[model samples]
Target chain A: MFERLLFEAPDFFTYYNVIFLLEAAARTLGMTLIGCTVGFIAGLLIAVLRQSVNPWTLPLRVIAIAYVETFRRIPFLVIIFIVLYAIQPLMENASLLTIATIAICLVSTAFLSEIVRAGLESVPKQQIEGARTLNFGAARTLWYVVLPQAWRVILPPAIAFAVMFIKDTSLASHIGVVELTFSGKMFVNRGFSPLLGFGAVLVLYFLLSYPLSRLGTYLEKRLDPSRRS
Target chain B: MTHLDVRDLACSYGSEKILKGVTLSAEKGEVVSLIGPSGSGKSTLLRALVGLTLPSAGEVRVAGKAVDYSSRKSVRELRSQLAIVFQQYNLFQNMTVMRNVTIAPITIKKRPKAEVEALAAELLARVGMEAKHDAYPEELSGGQQQRVAIARALALQPEILLLDEVTSALDPERVNEVLDTIRRLTDEGITMLLVSHEMSFVREVSTRVVMMDDGKVVETGTPSQIFDSPTHERTRDFVGMILKH
Candidate 1:
């Protein structure tokens, strides 16, 4: 691993290629941003749906549960293949990148929903009563009191899911989206150096996940007033 | 007119009845102390009055208006006029002591921010917690938190305040601080329905004393009438347990 990294060092900062890597990293970041944003919002709605007591909401809840269970149980690559090939006819002229993002978001949303639901449950029942006793109607209670406190608890796990979702963007390379993983694959094929190319992919994945994991830990500690000195 | 009336209130959790046909009343500015052994329905009666728990069969009227559990609006209005302080110090842990006091005023009453803040500061000072304004609930001692809880309850300017053993969770030395605050509120003539085992405080602060056991009010009378003049065997036993302490 060290030998391959040393040999690749001379070519590492070559401007044209560095630009290409930079562009690919940007696309990866974009995928993470778009995917997590859409996924978190959609996941919240689905989680709320799953908890809904209404009879009509039961079928919707079932569909959401089925969606979460289905994607989470299957491999990310398999879901990408199904979305890329089976849904090709539905895309019309839509870009592959957009299609890949949708697939990544759809899958991430399943796991994110469970995290959000658990976060909602972790909030103390007294907090809800505290709001109600203050005459915050149900909507205000949820918006102002419960969700604010729940967000503090939910944030750390949601960040973990975000990092996982970012890493899963690598699977999108199979569909030719030219993300970090795809660029790495192309470099390896051209140079006939699997170790150097994939090593860079490993570094990129670490770079993406490590900061978020650290940030998640930092936030988890910060959000808990009891943990602070 | 009665500021609050609970008529034949009955509440249950699944098969176990927590409150059995409990009837109680409080007039404006009256301090009524409901004393009993543990699990004797005093707390349940207070919770039911605030709609925190729906009674199985009963009526609760606040300031001449009926609280209809079926009507969300009625419950909301009733809740606004009623605030409860718990033995567990149920002030929101995430909020500062001052914010805990100001929450109802700002969020529910829609009072001007300046006015609410001013009143919150005043109430916190009244409870002798003005210095701990910015401190979060976890940072305070149990008695301090209970004082903040009382201030929080008072922020609504409610017609009735239900105190469920507010000092029970405090340390021995801290108990007097909370009790002293309650004593102050009583002196100010706030309408208070207190459930407490602090018989001395009950005798000192309450105009009327109620003895409850096995989910019923065994006796109700002036504190002197009930304390000096015994009525039932159960009441005598309850009085004996507290007086022995």
Candidate 2:
């Protein structure tokens, strides 16, 4: 296997094959980034909506709770197929990548909203009451007081979820989205050694997630209330 | 008209009533202290006044304008005229002392930044926290945080200040520092409604003292009237118990 890997090293490093792998790696990163970005924003909205005490928001709060609770319990692969068929009927020409990305967004939003909710709740109730007494509206209170305190709690878990999804995006390969893992399968099917093909894929995954985790650590330190002046 | 008028105000947490038809009023520049045992609804009264805890029923009039808790504009109007200092300080942990003091005025009220900052500086100085503007809440001791909380409330330029057990959470030695700050405010002409366990401070600073028990006001009178010459049986018992310790 070592000799075969060594022999294929030159051919595997060919411009076209390298581009193919790089494009696949980009897709994996793109899906994770786009999914988690959409998820975090939507999750934050859902979390905030759920926390509101207004009578009019009750319906929205119920829908948000049902969404997070339901999607979180469903498997990622199952969601992919569900979305694949669901979207195909609505938009007959929808790409596999789009279907897979939608599934990732749905799942990440569910998980991240719970994380954001817990973060928002960690801020003492007195802090919010303090804001209210000072004449702060709901949006101002959140922006000025709650979100600042919540970021410390929300960042660590949010980043962890994003890192986890980097690997989870490989599951998108089942729907023929041609992300990192799918590229490895393609290389192996083309008669390249399995170890070499999969090994490159493994390195690319690590490369994507390591920087993200490091960014998370940096944010956690920067946002620490005790450390800030 | 009373500076702050709470008429038959009632509040509840679920089925448990906290403030049951409690009526109270504070005239302009008057220091009215709510003295009672825990769960007497003193804090809840203050919370309801500021719209923090919605009053299940009753009317709160600030400067002759009735507050409607169900209306956002009315609550906002009420809050703009009143500010509260909590027992735990509740300083924005994420901000510097300066930011906590100036945030509401600068952001919510859209007051000019320079003017608000200048007032904040003066308020912090008055509270003896001038040197700690850059410090965070976690960096301050309990008394210092309470002082900063006072400064934060004052920076709002509120017509009335509600202090809900502001010094109860402090250490014995730290209590005096906060009391001294309130002492300075009593003569500053800001109407204040405070809930405190510090008997001497309450007596010394209050223009009027109200004794409450079981979600009702037992009596309202001057410090000397309530403390030296008791009126109601409940007031006498409460005063007797507190003075004993």
> Once superposed on the true structure, which residue ranges of model 2 sit more than 4 Å away at CA?
A214-229
TM-score of each: 0.92, 0.95
CA error at residue B19 for candidate 2, angstroms: 1.5
Instruction: Rate residue B44 of model 2 by lDDT.
Output: 88
Q: Output the lDDT of residue B214, model 2.
A: 91
Summing lDDT over every window of 10 consecutive residues in candidate 2 chain A, give the lowest-scoring window. A220-229
TM-score, chain A only, candidate 1, equals 0.89
Per-residue lDDT of candidate 1, residues A135-173 (tens digit):
877567667766777887789889978887788898889
Local accuracy of candidate 1 as per-residue lDDT tens digits, B59-171: 88887887898677888888777889988887877678888888778877888989999998999999999899999888889999999998999888977899999888889
Judged by lDDT against the true structure, how good is candidate 1?
Answer: 0.84
Candidate 2 residue lDDT tens string, A71-161: 9998898898899999999988889998899999999999999999999998889888888888877898899889988888899889989
DockQ, every prediction: 0.62, 0.82
- What are the TM values for chain B, all candidates? 0.97, 0.98
